[model samples]
Target: MFKKPLHTLKTSAPLRSSDRRKLKQRVIDAFTLDPELGDALVPEGILTIKFNTHLDEPGVAYLSPEASADPLWFSLGKGSEELIPSVYTLWKRPDLLPFLSTPPAVIPILVGGADLMIPGVVHHPSDLKEGQLVAVCQYTHRSKNGATLSVPLAVGRMAVAGDRIQDGEKGKAVFVLHVWKDFLWDMGGKPQDMPEQRPLAALVDQPESEAAEGDEEIPVDKLTITAQPAYTPAEISTLLQASLLQALSTKIPASAFPLSASVFYETYILLFRPAFPHSVLPPGAGTENSSDIGPGNPQNITIKSSAHKSLTAFLKAMDKAGLLTSKTAPKQNELLVTAVVDERHPSVAAHRGFVTLGEVEARAAKKAVNEEKKREKEEEGGRRVEVRELCKASGRTIGWVEGVGGSPKTLYEPTELRTLLNAYITDKGLVNPREQAYVNVGLDPLLLGAVVTPPKKGVPQKEVEFMKRDEVMKGLLDGMQAWYEVRVGGREVVLKKGALKPIRVEVKMRQGRKACTLVSGFEAFGEGVVDAEEMSEELRKICAGATSVSPRVGGPTGTVEVLVQGKQAKVVVDYLTEKRGVPKKWVEVVDLVGGKK
Candidate 1:
């Protein structure tokens, strides 16, 4: 079983031109023998870089293609100057396959991020020493011939010498850095399954023919020196029984009553002929001249007529043995199966039980639940909770109110209300075509009186155009009643916002024990024609401190806020309203200059 990764990741500053050059140089030096691998992994079009401090040495991830949000290469430093590929990178790039090798049974455990056990390793060169980069592969057998060994499951790692692995040590043989389907693989979005493994030396030398050259035709004589004995009747029977059970579990559903044996055999059972060819295949199965049947289609490997006759006979035999109930045709070409083979059937009782459709479904369901639980635990540290808050203007629909810093769910600050109003206007298409900056109240009467105050005694206009955007936003918020959203576990209740405090500027302690001021309601100020970067820079200079902008997960783009250094809440609010032209009504000083709001 796999355990959740303990390390957390945060977005780091984008690499400058100078830093990119330095990173490329380091990669080139580390992979001196394989220059193309170094280039493909850390391409020039990288978008972002993230740092992981959890490992023995710090890890750096390089994302590329300028548009992709996920990293293509995750590199870990063995010491100061040398670097090795992480397991994640190896899964995607098979060109590095010459480095490491392992056996088949160790693949699942490696995908779960477990260390490679010494006992499971089949082969590695004696020249392979500790601290070298390597690739791990499963000793897979050819699909058509089990005697010929092939390497299909490829992973990457730091190397440990063969002598050390043979020391009978109980610890890990290879320290697994990453794996397929782990948290890092799923970081930006759903990752595709790792590519099928290819020959190690060929992939390293010829990149273009890797896919076409995956399977090599090896003669059976080369696979074994001694002649093999023919399978006995009992062995053939066991193989057929296992194949029958597998086909039943995968193709038949519990609710599919009175199934047709002819359709089942044609679709499901025939597909297994390649796996159990010697036991399940009908006599002279592939001897037919099926070339005239169709174009671009290979000859039928299993003769349909013979397979149908044999399948009907097999079903009837099972029915007589009381494994299932079946109705057979006179020509033995079809059968109607009624019920599944009961688990308590005497014939299969010794082999645990007959596998019914219900049992197969239960096992599938259990697997889904375990995967969901694992994903939830991986995201446990950062939870996105939405609160139901009534829009002061349109109380008919509940608006989503999200948590900021540490605050109770009540009342919408003027800035937060502004974001909601803009969203409503966009959603309703209420903007006048003639005047893009003005709202067209004719689309919805509620948006007129509720969203903005009625025209004043001397005013003649009735829409958003007459007033500034801030004035219209303020008027709408003042006209509506406040509401509160209370949440407990999975249940949420909404009530009127009575005597609830508004939003404010709060200072929080971040990494390195630095005090940073968090301004929550500035979301609306960054929208439309507003310049977020210019505003952030101004705040930094005004407060004489460093500043950064971080978007709240699952929150609107309008809610992306700024973080300023030290205790500058009071100063920030004054600057926002007076210097930046934000209205004072939209700015609230709910918290003290140096404390929590």
Candidate 2:
């Protein structure tokens, strides 16, 4: 079964150019429909085709399933997408509408840029080829608040795609697809599926209205031809010079300008000029040896020589030129030599580098003398230690001690008592030096017992002196007792008594019962016992002092030891005056001094 090759339907001559132009305009109009799409078309601008289905598959058939369609791919102009939206809108025109709905699934041929292939086309238009440069109109996609639209921009091209489709009329409609050669392989569709076609130079070339004067409209060959704007030679030269200056300025100094072989030669030529000859002798001077004058006003000169010969030549030249000058030069008889001394040598201490023997001997002698003095000081210190020990043992101050034969332990050992005494003396300044010495010698004054005299044997035990009532009264009268009285009038009174009656007194001596009680009575008008006995001794003494004394007695209550007319008498009375309790008064009987009553 021989199958006929598929062929593209050709459009009639009247429809070829006009229908193609309408389709191109429709593509450009698609961009203006959306601003975001328009912005996308601007930078590195691109012609994008978002197919309803995967581009690898055949396009949808408009009327019959037998029809075939495929993918196409191309580029918009470089950095331009303006032509796409306008051209895409033209695809809906009456003349081009048939192609869109054709049974063969009319694949749109976007003149500016495209991304799909049309079936049944072999070669592109005769005026276009691959790698031929072209301009493009591209639509960009944009989204705002959920709505998406397209906008168009213009761009230039680097290469072209090779694919075509007929316009189904007389003259075959040519499809020009622009592309970047660098991106040809990854156009997202296979070459077989999305057949690409190069754009015609005539289509992208300057418009007829912009054609230069006297320029003829000539048909171009299938080989790609590009016409670029002519560049000004003067502007190019200026740019080149600026580039060279920038490069050189970065490397060379201003002082290195006007570089040329002639300038190099001329600079060296000045060095050899007789007017400025190069010489070791300074500017105003002639030959170095021409100094016919003496050691005054020396000419300036700079000599160049190798390291090994520089010094030697300098001295030789100075001599030959008669320029040797010095305030005091060395005499021929003087000898010069280098010498080194070792610091570890014994003699080295006396002489640093160079010195006279006299100086060396003097220093050595001085050192020896210092050593002897040091030894003497050490011996003296040893002797002083022995003397100090002797002082300690002998209990003497340092000055009192003599000699050096004493135990060293004795120097620090102090008698226990003496150590305590000394510590006390130091802390409290010696109150009594004699007492301090006594304490140091192990004796305390307060600890000594008092001396006693023994009593004579055979003597009757001496009677204990008892205080009689009279004697107690006499003592009270002598102001030895304290007596106070509370009178009936509420006034307090005090008195001294010369005598008091004795009373029976009992003092309990038992543990927890140490108290004294007395019972006594006093006669009043020879009747009942006077209440005076019941009163305290203090009140009795006060009353007795104020009352007249009458010698009245009563039995048992009154008993007296009396001396009448110098004779001793004992009188007993039924009534008596008695005293009890603590004695609050004293009585005194002083010898009469020439009084007779």
Candidate 3:
């Protein structure tokens, strides 16, 4: 009875096939339905799958028997020595067995470790560390009918977290695995074969050292450190070409790649054509075709051959543009001369007085001729004569009887008398002694008397004549009128009516219009005339002052004497003389007849 109970308990507890399948389907659903579940199941030695459930709950289902068989027996969680389970062989679910039974078309593995081989990878059971596990998926090109063709290249997980692939060493081969399907399949029934591995063949195969070494290592000492080359017109053309190439090859999404290259080329041509013909490449290898030199390699050329023409052209242009200057001889001398006048010696009237006088003598001779003609007729009938005489007398008187006595005068030699007269006339006009007498001579008695008398003592005679009262008044009025005119017309006035005061009676000198003041006792008389009379009177007075006497001798015995009185006045007369005949007297004074009696 005890054996039967134990057996019954064991057999009765065993899971049914449907329930096991359901559990397996649930696990597969967990990996396929939830994207994150695939990442978590990778380390758990489990695979997830998705299923269409007839049941209400649609969720993760697990199949332990399939997950624990064969390669799974390695117990990756404990690191046991057993064959590891391939990720493709993991069961997705029990109930979804038919859908997941086929192995994946390709096993995805990260390329890593020694020599960057695919085998050195972390798969199911080991945790997928960063840069470890990756899945490569086939890339497909779709046709218009929805048919798909495999591409030579594959899309892979990058060396990043979550969907990461490992980075290989330098110069080591590396690859990433990409999966085409989204879901995992159940590992049931017969085991599936791994997919074919398609490796990428290298193009331009070269050793790492050789590719790096191909670049010329210019020894610093041997290499020329040229000045940075300036981009000239030609140089810029190459740069523009490079830019255009870069713009054309720039990655455009597949959707936009359909745009034709011709259109892009035309656009570039239109945009750069104006400057392209004149552009040049900067100095360097393959500068002439720099646009064609890709990032890979460049051709070599000499510095002179690379855009030197453009540079030379630019230098010539700079010279023509007057960007350079040099020292040169001056075109003209800097010194100059200027003329100026001497202001201090300007010409004036006084400077003209020193001119030659030949013209003055010519004028005098002409006047003499005119005067001789005027006197020619008067002198035609007159005979010229000369005379000399002498007389001496004495007188005495008593109280009752007056007695007089006289002596007969002897005649003087006429030669001595004539000689004395000629000498006197030459020196001081003429002279006649009281004892000698001459008549019909060109002399006046008043003039002779004036010369004979000694000047009175203590008397001051005026050099200039003075004006009388009426003349003074006239002059003053005229002066006042002139002052008024000048004052009214000029900028300033210097005189007033009351500026002068009278000191004495006014007297006019006959010789000039000037006037002088006389003392109270002194008297002066002349014509008293009104304005018109005054002018005529003044004229007559002028004429009288200028008159001279001419004597006539009818019978030689007759005598005449003229007395002219003035303030130190004198008179002159003209006489006619017979040639070789003698006259008794030519000049005599009656007042001196008795000889100072």
Candidate 4:
């Protein structure tokens, strides 16, 4: 059910006191947890996040008592009026759920959303009842210390009684619910990659190797071996082209002409991609290149990473190849442009049908991607939104800009605009020979036009002999239109007509001497704009405190102020501006918690 981005995240706040205490009791009761052990496992006082999965299915997760990153014991949905453990939960307490062990070769396929067949099961618990919740794990292995260890990769329910499943049974055994690459696992936050099980795959894929595998104890060391291949843009380009071609021919019909770039790639690309070639290395390189990513799995690869380099380039190449044509479309973001794909080309007969990766091959493709690309993930807040001040020459000054080897039609960055003015003065020897601080603005007609505004009416205009260098540059800048190019969170750089307003944040105490932070004037930043509720949630996450929204006292209609608990002026200022792409100067902060400015 959760194979896509959540339909909704209605409430992301920490669970209330009553709900938190109840959840703690449930964990203790279910696990038979000892008090000392339970204290660390389900830490008291620390926030226990309780939110709905996709807005309805309840989920509970606990952070580490200290220095927690990825959440542990995080699970969604309930069974028997209690929360069932997820694959993540099973990772922490592998023995919590009874398991059905299958060959490691099929574990990859099992996680690909496939129901486990009776034939695939090598070991099954005899007492399992139909519809019993069970963990699906690869065959257990011995650690170097001679201790047995099993890694559960998925969770499912038995489709049939365990006793009914035979070695050659054709019926389904485990009805898969959540797997390693599914949305649930993604929501759990993967702290580590899926563990590889090379030995089991060898025994399962080849009957001849089974006897040898049975006699030898497979060490955990053998399972950790992995393939490392750097996926180059060329191989990935082939996959991208095949996917695009497959999408054009099969996934999206000609009638669906126009779509946003995000829709085309996010929807159609994956629908037809897996069937095409997904290999990074040549054929027969073994299952070492297996990728665990499901077609529904979210990925870091974007259109920009393709061989063609960009969406526009892909379209140009498609047009060149007689595949299809595209019309200019709107941009949803810098990465997602609009597009209208027309597959009515004459050469449509030579179509390559579709691209698909089977359950096993799909993950193989992911592994190849992981090995080759290393995901090229963008770190959170890694790149700040950069705003550049720009200038475009006015009508009379256009020629002056052109004379200085600058583009009059296009905009110039502040430094570029200043450099152009300096070049004109230096080349023409307009700088005062004796007074280097001044420049002769009257030396040339173009220079005079660029360096001076027209005189007001009722007074004859006088040719200025010399002006201070800074004054001349100021006049030149005044002859141009002021513009700002704002790069907001993965969106296209936007050009605004005038200056933007600064967002104001302040910290102060309320009547009871309890501190609260107030944020205002944030609506002025486009795209980086935050609604009160959203700001409240973000603040809650950052500050681990309650937040609320109220009317901005005596402010414009429809405006609201975000109120966060405690003194959080510095963090609010950072989040509202730097994280959202607004420049630092566009935000103002004042702290009055302890009477300090």
Candidate 5:
């Protein structure tokens, strides 16, 4: 169903703590998962995406937990909200979902948006029922070290019931929905490596070719040459141990020791691990590239194998061996690759060298620097808000507005439009004599069009037309083109279609008599107009109280909320208009606490 781009109906901010806990509990119940594994499967925060599928069916998916992840789960059809773990989620814990294995030749067909037929199924769980969700993969996903990995390539629903498998069947077995390289996978910011595959000739009569049935081979000139080192001994545990010693002795210097364990592992260990060649090769961007898999080109490796269970365990083992010092950091208890590397240790001194180790270390150092810069850039950058701009002044509204030298092309701020309407009403002497706050709607032709409907045909008016001044003003503005202006430092971007959102300033009671003022909706004005941290610091000084800025959950995406101690709604409003030059009309002040602020 997600073979095409789904139209997003709405997207929610991160789930609140209470809601998140409830979701976790629900997952544990549905998947029959252990509490710890279930918790790890769910991210700290999830973005709820409600969308319309290709078939117009409503669907939802939970996206990235932190920042650099993919959609965690999605569901469609009758069980729309029944979260189905995405390929990304399944990669970490493939046992969480039931899967059907097909021959390797059939995988290329499934990746091309084809549903899995009953003939293609080589293996499936006995407990599977019709309409049950399943991961689609191949038997050839076996690693070189003689381990079969349950890596999923696509997700789909079972068309045939599990109980009816004894009887010979044909047609669709799994109704293919989402594929590995489909648009949904592209939502994630991080790139993923496709699992390796090998030919399996056991499925319903098909050729043993790598490409799908009836597929043509491309010209030799079109193929990119990917050269790589031939497969050596496939014992991963041994390779990892050797790579760890090499990385510590060569890549990480004595001065660089005592580093965060995660940093050292990410920067050094992974880069130095021996590469394992496979039939389905990963892109050799940072490593070496050639058409043939031979000597001189050191390829990449995998951490998903069973040999490596956890980094902490591996580091501790090395520490026990007296080759390095690994200990929990003070206070935080985080593992630290300490500054006590045994350079003269037997393992370090007797380590053999590889041809591309130097090239690999250089790349790793460059990558670490680049990643740090990227992280800083992401933190420093702010979010932008986009709203629709509505209709503009035209026809009768323009004709009357032209008397004041206004033109059809002129763009006025919302406040300016309200002021202009009030001036027109006052100039025409249309105020109700009996009520100071009321305006006689029938007193002017423009008011008749804007605020009053003319008598239908021969119908007579039953009562004198009148409306509250604010209501009358609202009618006039509605007839004219709607406008919302954004003031971002010294620049402005006036878009069309969406109504403007005001800067919301609200005050609420906290601990007994204590109160705090909350500010939001600054995205409409842009970050340049008011940096959250800067505004918080400014408020701290002006109000002589504590203030802070933080990202707001359950609101707009990427919204940063500002908070100040005490009931400072009035002060916040004044500061916005006076100091930031935010229009008076764009500041919405609400005081839940009784009395004036």
Candidate 6:
């Protein structure tokens, strides 16, 4: 999974006198006592620099006390320091510079997280070895006049001995641990390299590793191959030739004396290609020229060669070896392999030992089996969908409920119920004025049942007590009906014994508009069971005025608000209690006079 880059808090703290002195000594020793740097780092001296530390990184970050220095420019790590500043300032002190310089072409790849290969390395310390820390610096020509400078951009561990790297052996050289433009470098909030007028590769010479010859070429014109499979280009070219030769010698029937180039290629692809590392098609694929599709109808698998121009070259090599005879056949669009050379002949038999067909076939078989298993596993995974639980209150749907004990929750726990009650108190401002923490329940069933009602004998329910916080919360939890929610197909569905909250009513007026009555907080009313918009219209007919229904705004609970024209507060209260069977005490009316409610 990909995650967003997070900026961890970087805090500054003053170091104690003793620790400061010791760390200063270590810095001096680490930098080899550079006179200018050593003096400037001293506390309360020519420079008054402050050091800071980051929570996510291990280091003491310090800013340059010089007035001309960029405020964001800082050095990190204990004893060791990597200057997070302009690329131009990297070589300010030549005497203390770390690491041998490298060509500029490798910078982008280093930043992309690929370890440096030995062929890409130009220079390194002779004594550098595995696990040793090294810095990668590149020479950038800043001026058209050919003036160049070196700047350090990355630090990493040596994967191979430095001597081997310097010798230009073929292997991994450096494992990049950190590089410019990584998350750590983002702290400066500026480009780590000089702003490029063109792509970075075009600004420098083409990487030497990409070209067969060490010839100078424009970098942008060629696609550089940073990494290749285990086999080299030359090796793959040879293998293709050998596979064709072996297939012709072993698989062709003696009765088929004269074969066409098309037949040879088809036989090689179907019988020989699967054993190679870079085979394009799966084994047992139907021949491109054939219409039969089942397993019993084995067909030739035609594919382009992995290396450019290798197929033509391989055929020429085979012809020159006299192992096969060929002729141009324009009608079939192929070169004909007219006859098979004698297999018992010394030249043919000598080359025959090179390609171990049995071994390649066995390996290809194992790979095919693994691929089949992977396909089946992926199909099985596609069929599975995660199930979730949802919570419901009143007649309305709340949200999905995460189940406890890895099962969908069917009943609310005492603590969970208390949390809801506490929210209700806060939302309704039901706490007693005399004592802020105590809720004064005035015969409201929701509160009275929870606080006053008791569970059956030995029911393990917390005792309810007035004024006491725990007991009050316990009473609220005990009195409420037990209900839980589960989810189905991305929608929340209330399951078993659901509870509903009371409805809230209010009135308000806008400039140049009549006062409007508002009703909300009826999640227990059940979605789709009651149409708030229709109800509002019906209320308008009864009250003889305009009305509308809208979503409740600026509230913790998501519900609908029903509004009716004029002073319909008394009418709405009456209809809800008398006609709708809603508890009269549950509905609250405010600012009825002058529409301030």
What C-alpha lDDT do the candidate models reach, one value each?
Answer: 0.49, 0.24, 0.25, 0.60, 0.62, 0.48
TM-score of predicted structure 3: 0.15
Q: Using TM-score as the measure, name the better of candidate 1 and candidate 2.
A: 1
Residue by residue across 286-399, what tens digits does model 3's lDDT show?
444544322210111111223433323322332243321122224532211111112222221112121111122232233333333343333322212221122111111011
lDDT of 5 at 100: 74
lDDT of model number 4: 0.60
Tell me the tens digit of each residue's lDDT in model 4 across 1-597: 343334334433455667666766777787676555455555565445554432235555554434433344565665335455666667765556766775455666655546677755645566689988888877532222211225687877899987787533556788776777676667556767654443343322345555453222333232221123223444555556666655565435545656655456555654455422434223223233223211211121234434566666765676567555555544533333334344664343455454253333344434433422231223224334666677888866788988877776788886877787788788898889999999888778888887677878987888688999888778888888877666644544466765556678888889798989889876645433355666787789999998888899888997888888888888887786654545678778877756645
Who wins the TM-score comparison? Answer: 4
- Locate the minimum summed-lDDT window of 10 residues in model 1: 291-300
Sliding window of 10 residues with minimal summed lDDT for model 4? 292-301
As for lDDT, the candidate ahead, 1 or 4, is: 4
Q: What is the TM-score of each candidate against the true structure?
A: 0.36, 0.13, 0.15, 0.39, 0.34, 0.30
Tell me the tens digit of each residue's lDDT in model 5 across 133-175. Answer: 8888765422333223337878888887864443246456788
**TM-score attained by model 2:** 0.13
Instruction: Please give, for residues 1-597, the per-residue lDDT of candidate 6 as tens digits.
Output: 001132233444445566556656665675565545654454431222333221122343343334432222235445554533322223333223335444455666566545566655544556666766566666432223231335466666688775565332555677665566654454343444553322223224445574434223433223122211344334344555555656655646666755665566545533453333333222322334222211211111122322433345556667887767777777866677777665565554665433233443343334334443563455334322222222322211122122112123345565565566677666666677788767766524345443564457988755433455576665444444456442222334334465444577777775566787788875554431234755676698889888887777886666678878776788988776654445565567776556443
Off by over 4 Å in 5: 9-12, 77-79, 141-150, 166-168, 195-597
Tell me each candidate's RMSD, in Å, in order. 23.0, 61.1, 67.7, 27.2, 18.0, 21.0
Off by over 4 Å in 6: 1-6, 11-20, 34-36, 41-60, 66-90, 95-97, 112-115, 139-149, 166-172, 177-455, 458-597
lDDT at 216, model 5: 30
